[model samples]
Target chain A: MMKSWDPRIEEMPKEDLQRMQYRLLKSLVYRLYSFSPFYHDRMREQNVHPDDIRELTDVKKLPFMFKRDLRDNYPDKIFTSTKDELVRYHVSSGTTGKPTVVGYTQNDLNTWTTSLARALTSVGLGRGDVIQVSYGYGLFTGGLGMHYGAERIGATVLPTSVGNTERQIELMQDLGATAIACTPSYLLHIGEVAEKMGVDIKKDTELRTGILGAEPWTDRMRTRIEDWLGIKAYDIYGTSELSGPMFTECVEQKGFHVWSDIALVEIIDPKTGESLESGQKGELTITILQKEALPMIRYRIGDITTMDDEVCACGRTHPRIQRIQGRVDDMLIIRGINVFPSQIEYALMAIPEVGQHFQIVVERKGALDDMLVRVELTKESFSDKINDIIQVRQKVEHRLRNSLNVNVTVELVEPGSLPRFEGKSKRVVDKRSL
Target chain B: MDTQKFVIRQISIFSENRPGRLAAIAHALGEENINILAFSIAEANGFGVVRALVDYPEKAHDKLFSLGYNVAFTDVIAVRMKDQPGGLYEVAKVLGDAGVNIEYSYAYSGKEGAVLILRVDQVDEAIKKIKNSGATLLERSVFH
Candidate 1:
């Protein structure tokens, strides 16, 4: 039977959801105006008041908060609640620059755990199941966020964290873990380790489902993982600001259902900031409706996706989002053609000869830009024959050009030569000064 | 194929075709007191494959791998040819006539004769063809 954590919230009518969002939006704006100075000044500068947002569309009138706001404000400027009221805090990698900080009050923590619990339950994980979390713990929300959710469902939680593939496999088999949560890439890495140890995960382990997210993965990769580990893979979605892994795919695996009660979402043309119609690919903007510590209005998440309001086969009324294509910052413009690293990943994964490790390097050649895709061959396919290797390289290049509509040089490297990451693989290297 | 004949192991080092790469690799092997008897660099695109017949194949391989160079061993039959002209022509004619394809070949003149290293499609068949043509097959101990 199809299961939902909160049937009332998930199956609410469209009109009621919109009306609830409008009411919540109004109160959230006033609360931000009263508590947070950054929001107050921004709202005053834009000449938008709490009364201005009588309806939901007025959310546009409020200033859109760029990720830069978090950087500029630094530690506590964005926090609506004081330090004494805070229960916990999480920080992003800040790899690009200063790390974005988020805080949660006791109530906010409850909401986060409950939201993730709903997500886990929606994917068919519950009481009798032992959910193993493979995401990195500590400062990263991926591990603890999923950890609390599984506990909330009365399931035995295995806080294995990440790394130690042999131990992870041992625990998965000996403990009979029925469900596991981690990035799809990491899951595949574990499968590879299992194979090397001669432990057939499909036959040896009791894992039946996987909750995969944190990095964008293709359906082709999903099929490979399913065939390798014999598990049903579900995509869960969230950002640190909105709470980790709140939206998730139900058993249908059609799209990720966003809880309207917790957040409001909008798709807009990233270049112009104008709202786009549903089903049109664009930038995804979100507003945290239930957040207490740091409430953001129209926060641009930078993810690119389309929304579908059609009711899912699982009967959830919450609008679903197509799997993220790529982050806006990850798009590459090569010789007047726009390409996404995920698109290249999808194309590369489609080819059976290509291994999962790949990198796209964009370089300026004189006046024109050139893209070089470095991909590794599988161990079985790595050949000593130069002509055979060259043929495989040319085939990869041809497939990439067919998908990206631009000429790309594909270099076939030896197996295990390219760098691999434990979390969030870096696949693109831009060397052009322009 | 003679069971008594020893097959010489050729160490092929994968490297980028840039200046000083070969010298650095040679320096590493020389530092280990391993002598490189015969060596050839095959260039393709921007990369090169440096194949060397070292006195101690196993020690050379370990040193190269420890230096983080992509290295592998390939078996190639080494036959003694005349040091004068028509030496390569004779070896090539015999292999071609026997329907054996020589993928690549390299040679070095020594005190005994010119040592021709041939990597063919069929190693055993090429060994028979070279033996039938009256060419002296060198043993792995010849390099050692």
Candidate 2:
């Protein structure tokens, strides 16, 4: 039988869900127009009033919010709720610019936790299951978000925040953790540490499910993790701006189900700033209809993915967004071709001789763009014959050229030479910018 | 005579071509008191394969590998040549005429005689051709 934390909302009819979204969006617009000066001035500048947002599609009338808006507001200038109403604050570490602070009222926290509860339940995790939260805690939403959701689902929570992999593996064994939530890279790191410790995760540990997100990963990586560690890896999607890791893929693992009651998602053509129909790939824009402290209306999240309105096989009625292809800013234009690091990873993972670590270096030589992919050769693939190594490099170059539609120079580096990060790994080095 | 006894193990290390990389490798081998008999560096794009004949090939490989170097053992034939002009020509002509392709070759002259280490495409065929051509070949025990 199917299990859901909130069956009423998760299984609501399509028409009813849209109607509820429209109602919540209307009140949210009206509240912001009346109370928040930032939203009011932006709306007035765009000549959009609360009355303009009558139908659900009328959301197009409002101006799109941006990460810049949050940065410009800095600490909490854009928040609609008052300081006394906020129960907690989670600030995103703005690596590019000023950090954006998110304030959460008690109800806002409940809504965030409830969204995760439904998501966790949809993935078939509850009670008796031990979920190890491996995402970093504190200001980052990944840890606390999964932590609260796992706890709410009646599961035993093991708050093992990132790092100390050996110990995390020890706890995973000693505590008999059944599931873990963390970045895919971190999970891979744990697997390596476990193997080095002579602890076979598949045979010894009870871990079976992984909620991996917070960075872009490929389906090939999913297969590798599943086959290697003997775990079902599910992709979780959310940003700190949207209440921090809210929705995740159910056991079917098709895509992440974005709950309609909490937030409304839209795929928009990033260049023209126009909404696209379902199943068309574009930038992910969202409207947090029920967020009180910081309500985001048509916020451009900048992630590129397609949305599927068709209900999932899991029997949930919420729409599912496909796995994030790549971020808008992360997309690289090499020799007039759109290339993504994830695509390179996908292609590299397919080749048996290629290792997991690779770095892309892009530079402008004269008038042309030159891309060089530095791939680490796995120990298993290393050969004594120089001709064999040359063949591997040529094969890698050929595969990358076919996948990316751009000529690439492949350099076979020694294993463990490339940089490895505990969190998100920065694989691209664009020397052209410098 | 069994030519297999003449096949010697050559250690090849993959390294990025940069300053002090060779010195670092040499220092590590020196720390272990391993003598490099004959070595050749092959260069490609920004990387090099350091192929060497050492007295203690197994020990050198382990030390270098334990130090995180990508090391592999390749079977190469070390042929004894006359320590005079055309000494290489005699061996090169014999292999070329026998339809054996030498991938790479390095030579070192000691007080005894000049020895040519040939990395050939076909190890067994090269050993048989060299031995059949009346060319004296050094046994693996000579290097050890």
Candidate 2 residue runs with Cα over 4 Å from true position: A331-434, B1-144
Per-prediction TM-score, please? Answer: 0.61, 0.61
Clashes of 2: 0
What are the clashing pairs of model 2? Answer: none
Query: How much lDDT does each candidate structure score?
Result: 0.82, 0.87
Model 1, residue pairs in steric clash: none
lDDT of 2 by residue, A1-434 (tens): 23988888888999999999999999999999999999999999999989988899999999999877897788899988889999999876442324579999999999999999998888889999999999878877888999999999899999999878899999999999999998776787788788889999999999999998886678988999999999999999888899999989999999999999999999999999988999999999999989999999999988899999998887889999999886777666564234668778878888989787899999866434689999887667777667778888999999988777568999988777889978777899988631
lDDT per residue for candidate 1 within A61-123, as digits (tens), equals 888988778867787687888899998988763323245688989888788888887788888
Query: What is the lDDT for B76 in model 1?
Result: 86
TM-scores of chain A in all candidate models: 0.77, 0.78
Give the C-alpha miss distance for residue A413 in model 2, angstroms: 19
RMSD (Cα, Å) for all candidates, in order, is 15.4, 16.4
Superposition error at A402 for model 2 (Å): 39
Candidate with best TM-score: 1
